[model samples]
Target: MDDLLSGLRMPERVAPGALFLPGYAASIEREALRGIAAICALAPPHHLLTPGGRRLSVAMTGCGAFGWHSDRAGYRYVSRDPVSGRPWPAMPRSWRDLAREAAERAGYPGFEPQSCLVNRYDTGARMGLHRDCDEDDLTSPVVSVSFGVTAAFLFGGAERHDPVRKLAVESGDVLVWGGPSRLAYHGVAPLPRRTHSLTGPLRWNLTFRRVTHRQGP
Candidate 1:
């Protein structure tokens, strides 16, 4: 069964109210990667330290009205960037379109996102199992899209100890979670290093959300 499942395509997301859709960006790989590159040019990915004073290995940057931050203080979203003191880059149309489309497919409508967290994963980068509890609005769904090399997506139950479903997230795949499954513990496993024509040596994930707090100028 393990072999059969592995051979299966990206599964239909089954997280109650959570929605997952895979987009084939193969037709526009160049544009998609270029959009990501442009965003990186605006705000390069950097290792961020958690409140526990531990620095994450993945290079990350955010583009949108609100960006997620984790530091000595804690993990939260802020308006202006602590580094540039300016607003984070805006979500590119491709990113926004993919997010909105995923949300709609997931049965959530009118999802206007104000934040797009872009994370870059190299060979060993992995985001441990965690719940997205920082958002003020739990009603809004979280939309995540994968591009470049494939990775294992860990989607667990509400509790930390519950069993999890491992899904293979490939480039152009979108996952949406909300309603009953909004807070399910989810994250990426260690990414195997591989080169792609577009993303080269890494995989990119764009997480879109409607942040609870409003951004300031």
Candidate 2:
């Protein structure tokens, strides 16, 4: 991992224990996209219903031992896809390696993620600011990888109403947050009308999390 980090550009510190690594995944773009395609083919992407019964703007799917899901019952992780009633596709090794590498580069080493939630955003799609506190462990950092299109990321304090710092993130960017900033509120702004050679009009975000400390999917 040290050798790989040496080839990438230096990461910018977003906050205490938070890092924004621009183009950090550029070298693995092809493998990452391929892995996403394979995972979605089996599980497919669908908008999830929030506890309020509102449909999410972003289409979501995932691979790994546990997949994040929500539908009126509140947010949680499941071992299978609710839509297909099948075990969520296995996370690709390449995806796992990339996530670990990114986390290590950001100073959060030993991030063994059990979930990789993939969000697909199109024009006008957005995710409201929220904290990732549903994980079984809070010590592990959240590593996010972006592919296709460009979006504004809202990084805020622990409180939802706190001031937010917006950052423009392009394809191949990777952001990791943990430690003091582990539960910080963050999200993506509505995407503008745009297209990328790899994802067309869609923006892909893969978030890796250590969902559970125990075994079994």
Candidate 3:
């Protein structure tokens, strides 16, 4: 599926309530990167082991009120950082603003994400097909921002066997999905060994989600 979707193109609505905004984060790239660095400083990224004892290739950390975690116990959200035994770093205003604006542009207005998961993918790292179903509220949309090297995003339907479409996601791309397609399965293909001017040989992904329906202070 290489070159299936050309790089740096106009916004595309690939599915119902799912919109891809290419280079959407270009304006705030520096601030976003800084925010990520701060969050990682507070809660450094770490590889998580799956229930079956397989270690995830991607290193992960998070900011905001909740942090996504997976272990032999199960996949769920925790308010405290497992590493530091403290609350996850607060979500940066820039990060929240970008996420809210992106969600609104994708037709999901008034989105207030309570959690932002930061994932770092190095060469050969790939995520398997799975749905974002751990959130307490499924009605809210998910806003994802991509930075560093380009990646092929796999977007699938509701069923596991459903056909998938590959889309090339470059640095500064923002993807928003919710409503009817809230639980759609998706994953990232293995990243090729390449270097970006800003992030070197790695790719960073920020996924903003409204984990609960409760309002934040």
lDDT per prediction? 0.82, 0.90, 0.91
Candidate 1 runs further than 4 Å off: 1-11, 24-28, 213-217
Sort the predicted structures by lDDT, highest score first: 3, 2, 1
Number of backbone collisions per candidate: 1, 0, 0
| lDDT (Cα, tens digit) per residue for candidate 1, span 79-178 | 7666788888887887677677778878888777889988999888999999999887788899888889899999998999989888888788778999
**How well does each candidate superpose onto the true structure, as a TM-score?**
0.91, 0.93, 0.95
- In order of TM-score, best first, we have 3, 2, 1
Give the alpha carbon lDDT tens digit for every residue of 72-139 in model 2. Answer: 99999999899999999998888899899999998988889899999999899999999999997888
After superposing candidate 3 on the true structure, give the runs of residues whose Cα lies further than 4 Å from its correct spot. 1-8, 215-217
Q: Return the clash pairs for model 1, or none.
A: 19-176
lDDT of 3 by residue, 152-198 (tens): 99998899999998988889999999998899999999999999988
Best by lDDT: 3
- Model 3 error, position 148 (Å): 0.1
